[model samples]
Target: MSTPALTLQGLGKSFGDVRALHDVDVTVESGTVHCVLGENGAGKSTLCNLVFGGYRPDAGRMLLGGNEFHPDSPAAAMAAGVAMVHQHFSLVTTMTVAENLLLTQHGLRMRRRDLTDRLDEIAQRYRLRVDLDQRVATMPVGARQKVEIVKALLREPSLILLDEPTGVLDPAEIDALIDTCRAVAADGTAVVLVTHKLGEVARVADAATVLRRGTVAGGGRMSKTSIAELLTAMVGRTAADLDPTVAATLGLDTAGPRAAARQRHSTALDATAPVLSVEGLCAERADGSTALAQARLAVRPGEIVGIAGVEGNGQSELVAILAGSASATGGTVTLDGTDITAARPATRTELGLGVVPEDRHRDGMVAGMTIAENLFLGQLGRFRRFGLLDRRAIGRAAQAELDRFDVRASGPWVRMGSLSGGNQQKVVLARELSATNLRCLVAAQPTRGLDIGAVDFVLTQLRRAATEGCGVLVVSSEVPELLALCDRVFVAYRGALTGPVETADLTAAQQISELMMGVAA
Candidate 1:
């Protein structure tokens, strides 16, 4: 028989008494994507870690090209044709793209120019464009992730694993990565993708495996299985029970219960004066490139307005400037008629401006801290008694908020990083929305990596915020999300802004697609 790319037989793993995975079996063939699906603690990571040599299995064996295979470390695994790109990056912050890629292989010496040319060639073959001279620290999170994928592809591994790759990327970049994966798989490599997005699986995966509570639940060939069947297997719930918008995203027939619920809570919008407004707002990237130019928009009380565009087209810079992480070179931004263009983040917060950053872990909260501590960061005074923080008070309130947000965690004492992406986002939202004085919110890619349930909950929370008269400005890479949730949307392209176009008027999907790609009205 011809050898398969990889095969696992009855894999099992345990940490003390906690069985992370058991009797998990999967086979990957040459030139195909095999997706792993599950909720946060479904042993997807355990399986990926075992394959990449981050952990050793307590039971079962692996065969690589029909031969027994075992590796002691990640480096060893890479040497044996198993390459992995982690959800978090591993590139040096101070290095340039070329410098980082050149360091991929150790003890191999070559002229810098020659190696760069070869790297460029590989990147071109995959159609991934990287700014060779750009420093890692200066690039956006999405750009950095692209570089990591390219680094993994450069190794020419027979098996490649990508963990939650699309979380930080825009739609265009995600599409490009999917294309790249197909190209590599066509070259006879096996691709294992661990993802929460079913739509993406529909787009890229040839076959799938669903993990539930450390065991294989169900999965099948994409050509043979329906999306409804896949969703039911992964989540163990009927589509009718899901939020309308969530169901819509999964290509299911959707109802309007979520929207109807929001409507029940909503008061009439006061559009005479905006709670947040921007006029001719201009900003520059860290490298002095124009990031935003002549931007104009407004969010009325009890309204959610969104900005949609391809990544790297001023969205990040606009959010950064508004959040007070970066300075605007020109123009003005006002929160409730009070100019805040020069306000610090803390000052903005004090002025009732809450922000949910684009990359939640990196900018929204400290991962190493407990959820309670993270929730009250810079506001310990609320729970302070006699100049000491009241731990019991904080824990009680934090737990209540977590429960309200449907955050699945042991308790408020758990480390923020220990929670899944969706749960982390819930915690972030809990902190920001709980503020008694919150007047406006700026959410950047708020639902970036969450599962369907989490996305529904978060969007519901956003609607609830609007219902309570908190003006909202959402910056997103997905046009459909904006169209579904926002009252209106603005299209950004090449750092230029256009719109305030009502989603109701923008009925055709192609019209919005054209606008997103910078087509003239």
Candidate 2:
């Protein structure tokens, strides 16, 4: 048999005192798609980073094509026929797509024509059609992802690694990406897909490995194992015992929690008084072009509503207006009959409206700050006494929240950036849900990049909020996420809002997708 594309004997790495990865072993054969599955912070990224020479292994070794391989840097890894597409991209947004790819070929000093030819060749081969002249900053998340994939393929490496590649894609984009993975493997390149999406793992991978806290937990050939089994391995249990949200995500039965939640709180919500409402909302982009148009919606007390669409279909603009961080050129937004269209974020928070931002790191928390400081960001007045910040009081409250939210951290002193994606999300949820006067909540992509367990926690928290008489409005690209959590779902397309179809309605899903694609009924 031909030599395996990559073989890790006893790979290990550490970050200061934390054992990020232990003695781990995996083998990836050429001409096959191998999936590396794990929960966030379970060392999946660390292993891929080590393999791509983003970090040197603290112990053990790796082999590529039956040759001893220990790359000291990313460049060395590329030179040794290994390429990686990081979960968070490293491209320079100001540059054009062509420029970004050219940066990768700097050492080779290929002529402009040669670069174009190579890009065309790879693009055609993988069906990854991206506008080479388009500025990276202007492209959508899915396009940026395709650019990253193309950049890796341009290297023509024997092995390629992708970290959570589908986290930003819509269903159609995901299908196309999976096809590319198969094509790459068919050409004899080993493709290591590092992700927590067990469904995708089952759909695309030939073999799989599961990691939990830096060690192999369980895995097998894709044909031999099931998504349910891989999920059980990742989170340490069967689907039956998992939260309803988790079960719904895994395509297992949860008996429609949305309907159950409404039924449970029907008496309280019978008045059908909208806790949050928008009427003919119109918004503009920074360049003064229309971003949202004539949008209208309502969320009654104890109700969970959803907005679903492809990315960049005015979802961000709608979210910004709802979050009280952007202006609407016209129309009104009301919270319990109070007009708050021109309200500031702080004012909205104090007026009983909590918002979980789209990009948590950018909008919600300060990564460099301590958890205590981040937790009390908007409500610091609660601890300010006689012109002095009450550190001791903040610490106690932050610790209490940590415990309540089950946020795994080293007390409240740890930097917000140090937590995993899941934990950071938990902290965001804690900050918003802890308010004494939380009447309505607006969350954007609530479970976007979270793992199964984290997803379960976040959804449960939202349900609990609804259970306690708070209205919820969630914006997400995943249809499954919306169907699983919302009592009613809407579609946002070309800045127009359509449908508040009941998720429980027999043909609701078909209608939602049709509306999402701008279909008129």
Candidate 3:
């Protein structure tokens, strides 16, 4: 057989006391895609960084085409025919795509016209179409991802690493990206895909490896291994308890006959009366661009309603209007017959509105404060005693809330910024759900950056809150998440709401995908 494109032999890496990778080994043959599967904190990122020269391995060795390879920096890795596209993009927003591509080519000077021509030729040859003159800031999330892929390919690397590439893409864009990867792999380039989405694995991966707690759990050729075996290796559990319907969609067979019985039962909602009502909502951004236009929706008590769309298309504006952070230009918002259209954020909070914003670090909690302080931020009056503040009471309340949420931290006194992303989200959920007289809960992208376990916990909490008669609205770009949890889903396209389609009636993801593209299903 020809030499493997890349090989890792007993690679190990550590950060202080944490063993990020331990005795891990993987090999990728030429002209094939190798998928790395793991949950959050499962060492997937560390392994990718080790290969891309972001971190030096503490032990073992790496070989590139049977030659011992040690790269001291990303530049060295690039020079050695290896490239990585980070989860968080590294492109300059103000620069044009052509300039961004040229920025990486050191010691090479070419006229702007010549560079554009060369990039156009490469893009045409690879079928990766991109506007060379468009500014990165003006491009949508999907377009920016395509640009990143083009940049990686411009280097003519023998190996490329894509980290969680499909997290922000729509269905059509995801399919296009997968096609691009396949086309590149056909040219004898080794591709390493690090992802959590099982469906993508079944679609494109030639070989799969599962990493659990810094060790190689299991792996094999995709054609030879069963999905049940793969899931068992990644999650460290039998598939017996998983829902068969969801499992089958994810390309895995259910382990037991009772899998159908474990599916979440849909909650019934009253059709006539809505706890929260929004009609003809119109809003604009700071740049005077339309953010929302004529958006209308309703959520009944004890119901979980989902808003599905791509990254943009008025989701953010609607969430802001409901949370009282943004003013609506024209429309009416009512909360249980009370007009909250002109209400302040504090007033909305007083009226039993609990909002978990999309950016947890920016809008959910104050990172500089201690966990205790963040827990009781808006309800400090409850802990106040006599003419002075009650420190002991506040501490006790915060500790209780943290414990109730199962937030794993050093203590309540720990800084909120010091906790993990999942823990910070737990703090947000605990604060909002534990509030007194909570009539409505608005969760926007609640599980965006969380692990599998954290996502399961958050979804359960939302369901439990709905069961207790709180109106729940979940706005997310993830269709599978909405299908799994929401009682009914509303598609948002260009600020218009369409189809409060019952989850029971929705049989396939293509229906939702069509609606997301503003097309009738």
Best by TM-score: 2
Q: Per lDDT, what order, best first? A: 2, 1, 3
Each candidate's TM vs. the true structure?
A: 0.92, 0.96, 0.89
Which lDDT value does model 3 have at 265?
Answer: 34
Please, what's the RMSD in Å of model 1? 2.7
Question: Candidate 1: misplaced stretches above 4 Å?
Answer: 107-117, 120-124, 129-131, 251-270, 506-508
- Ten residues in sequence with the least summed lDDT for candidate 2: 259-268
Kindly list the per-residue Cα lDDT of model 3 for residues 402-484, writing each as its tens digit: 88888877688889987767789999999999988899999998877565556667877998898899999999876766776
Q: Give candidate 3's whole-model lDDT.
A: 0.82
**Pairs of residues at least 3 apart in sequence or in different chains that clash in candidate 3:** none
lDDT tens per residue, model 1, 398-494: 9999888888888999899888788899999999999998999999999887777788889999989988889989898766677667777788888
For candidate 1, the per-residue lDDT at 400 reads: 93
Instruction: Record all residue pairs in model 2 with backbone atoms less than 3 Å apart, i.e. clashing.
Output: none
lDDT of 1: 0.83
When superposed on Cα atoms, how far off is each prediction in RMSD? 2.7, 1.8, 3.3
Deviation in Å, model 2, residue 432 alpha carbon: 0.9
Q: What shift in Å separates residue 120 of candidate 1 from its native position after superposition?
A: 5.5
Summarize candidate 2's per-residue lDDT along 364-405 as a digit string, tens digits.
Answer: 889999888888877888898999999899999999999999
Which stretch of 10 consecutive residues in model 3 shows the poorest summed lDDT?
A: 254-263
**What lDDT would each prediction earn against the true structure?**
0.83, 0.87, 0.82
